[model samples]
Target: MSPRSGPPLDGAIDVHAHYVTPRLRAAMVDAGHAEPDGMPAIPDWSPESALADMDSLGVATALLSVSSPGVHFGSDADARRLARDVNTEGAEIAAARPDRFGLLASLPLPDVTGALAEVEHAFDALGADGITLHTHYDGKHLGHPEHEPLLSALDERAAVVVLHPTSPPCWEAVSAGLPRPLLEFPFETTRAVASLVLSGALERHPRIRFVVPHAGAALPVLADRIAAFSLISGGPPIDVAGALRGLHYDLAGFALPRQLPALLALADPDRLLYGSDLPFTPAPVARGLAEALAADATLTAEQQRSMRRGAAEALFPRFARPGPPGAAEPRPDDRSLRGDQR
Candidate 1:
């Protein structure tokens, strides 16, 4: 762990906040899908309003990425165009307020070539902090051979890739009127992590730092089961627990007594980072969750502090409060860090 950059660095660094630009919102509305992926009505968001909420809630910075039902809404050409537009705008937002914003450039995945090209531009030209990827593109999850080249490229650069759960193509519909995110989102996250572990993608692409969303979804509860099956099957000697431990996790959704304890058992507690999942979870819910965490007896002040800012500061120190706070200046290598948080 890196040294703590104290005091003014006390504010939380939200790695999971989503940005819904006017154009992106309009595109969703035009798709004949007002409730994309069953997320109620799309919540409103703007950088100014987000910053106000951040200030009110003690958030120092909120790294932005497109939320559920990512930009690749069935047309490769449109996906590519939307990706470029979204990323360019996001990068500009981060550049405009480097201290309070960070960009995780959206890539047009399921189209490897376009994703690769965008990755190059995001880092080289836009100076984006990292890339965000969905658990599965089309029907292929992250571990599928189709994504190996892209993962390999990210590994070569030691990029921080954040994985958000998108409803998999094969998911069955539940009849209870429950939203997809109510259960499917977390399951999809587990499915992707399981895919990565079973197929050895996590092991092969060792340098790529993955950030798992929703407190690693169902990963903690399923850890032992995944391990026993993989090891006993006599496959490619998988270390499921080790793989889970190596990846980072965010406190999105509700990281309380249940999720937090399970997460700590699986990985270093220091790996925990703060996430608001704002706009989708909305500011009010986000605020309530934050207050709950602060009052949770299961976590210590030290532990909570780490979740808020300390751990994230170490993970992506480039965003550490700069100038007057006595926090260290971001080193040359700091730009390489990226993480997934929703």
Candidate 2:
């Protein structure tokens, strides 16, 4: 079938785009991840190709990140080296086209010390717009007490933390041999968010702006259920809906007809952001989804515009205005990056 077409996204900022450098690919392959996370293979990527895809999708800037399986395989030392290499490569990619690309650096998680060190380098030295974290690392979800130090550092910086889902610990038993992305990914996202809420991490790290991807996965549908049960379970006295409203959600995967509506029910409309999940989703498929979102009648034009660009501008104001010809846009100053709006 021919690809669907719609109005150009027109300066939209895609919050969930991905990148895989040669070093990262080689490392994954060496670690027996020739097929990372049970996928057929890692998608091919390059700066030129990414730029072409962005142009076709009308994305003025894409915040690039390394997707699941992350940098850690088993050894913390190896993971640290890989994380540094990939983050450096990502920073270089964004540096080449500051106006068209921004980076969300990866961390060697499940290794808190290494992660904290990388966080310092990624933000203070690399000028990363944010940090990309998986829902869990080494079977430990984001709310684990061990991650408190890392969380505290992020909170201090008011960092933008984008949560991408990885294969959950019980994938073998529960996945029925199917790829994790189909079912396990969203479930893992829900689990991680719940962990943060029940553990009081969300409350403690209020300054950290967390961006939940895949239209908040299963969180929207289960928000009320969680809130109702938390009281009985003696979990933190947090208002689930209010907590969701305070965080941002990205429309990256197939969000129409169900996910988007459910997410809107719990999340603030102004906190919605655009995400293309490119390379992994394939450019054509991502474009079709973007077209569908643009044409969805449920959202008013203003709402659509906000998802496309406005909300993201508030978070990454460096892209709000264009730079001079042949000049690279400056990295967002810490104050501008930590915009007043959540």
Candidate 3:
């Protein structure tokens, strides 16, 4: 881990945020019938809007990733094309700003060939920072053998994989009566993590960096239960806690006072990154983060600093440059660094 950069460096890097374009909206509309309720209206997501938010909120830089239903809506060909468009638009934003923006390429899973091909295009050609994958494909859990090749490639390259949640197999119950994102999202994330852990996906792809949203989607609360269930059922004891130690968790939609301490106990504080899940519900996660960081003064100044900024530098590394607070300009080596990591 890098040394803490201290208090003056209030530079925040949100690793779990979303970015969409008109092309993405048109793609979504073209593929799907209607926009679901509670999802934010498609704002004009430009470099200007992101920069303006960074300026207002004291966020220095944000690592941009496509949100769920990411370019994987239609046929493999259509999905691949949409993924390219989304990545190209993101690259354009980074090209113009080079400060406030970076991109995580949205992968078209279930289409393994397309995924591997896009990995090359996005990382080698467009210079995306990382890859964003939904927790599951359609309704299949990530534990399936089909995902191994993709995970293997990512592991070989040491790529950053940001996992977002999608609706589960039981869609009617989740989509109809329950809140689409509020309830189902976290549930799906938890299910995916459990499936991955049980199927030894984490063991196979240890080098791939992961940033799980919604404070790791209730993982902290259910860690013990998972372990107990696995053990009681004569399942292999694979040290789930140790595995999670290497995973990075983001503080998005996590406001409970009790949750932070539990997270601190299980995962390295340096592995926690700030996330706002912007242009979506639960606006301005910083206020909640401030409360959590301020909740425990017993934590050393260095620990607090890591929670605020240092952890992000370690995970993303592109935000380590000198800049004013809330600066939105991309670093000079942004593209190269992203490629190097990939």
**In lDDT terms, which candidate is top?**
2
lDDT of 2 by residue, 1-342 (tens): 334453357668999999999999998899898877788999999999998898788787899999988999899999999999999989887877777789999999899999999999999889999999999988999999999999999999999999999999888899998889999999999999998888889999999999999999999889999898888886547777777789999999999989898888898788899999989999999888888887797678778877887788878877675542212233343345332321
lDDT string, candidate 1, 36-122, tens digits: 676679888899888877765667788899987888878888988998899989988887677778988899889999999999988
**Candidate 3 at 93: error in angstroms?**
1.1
lDDT, residue 266, candidate 2: 90
Q: Is candidate 2 or candidate 3 better by TM-score?
A: 2
Ranking the candidates on lDDT from highest down gives: 2, 1, 3
**C-alpha RMSD for every candidate:** 6.2, 5.7, 5.6
Candidate 2 Cα errors over 4 Å, as ranges: 1-7, 322-342
**120-183 in candidate 3: lDDT tens per residue?**
8988898788888888886777777888988898888799888888767676755776546878
Give TM-scores for every candidate, taking all chains together and pairing residue i with residue i: 0.89, 0.92, 0.85
Candidate 3 regions with alpha-carbon error over 4 angstroms:
1-9, 33-40, 232-235, 282-300, 322-342
**Candidate structures ordered by TM-score, highest first:** 2, 1, 3
Per-residue lDDT, model 2, residue 244, is 76
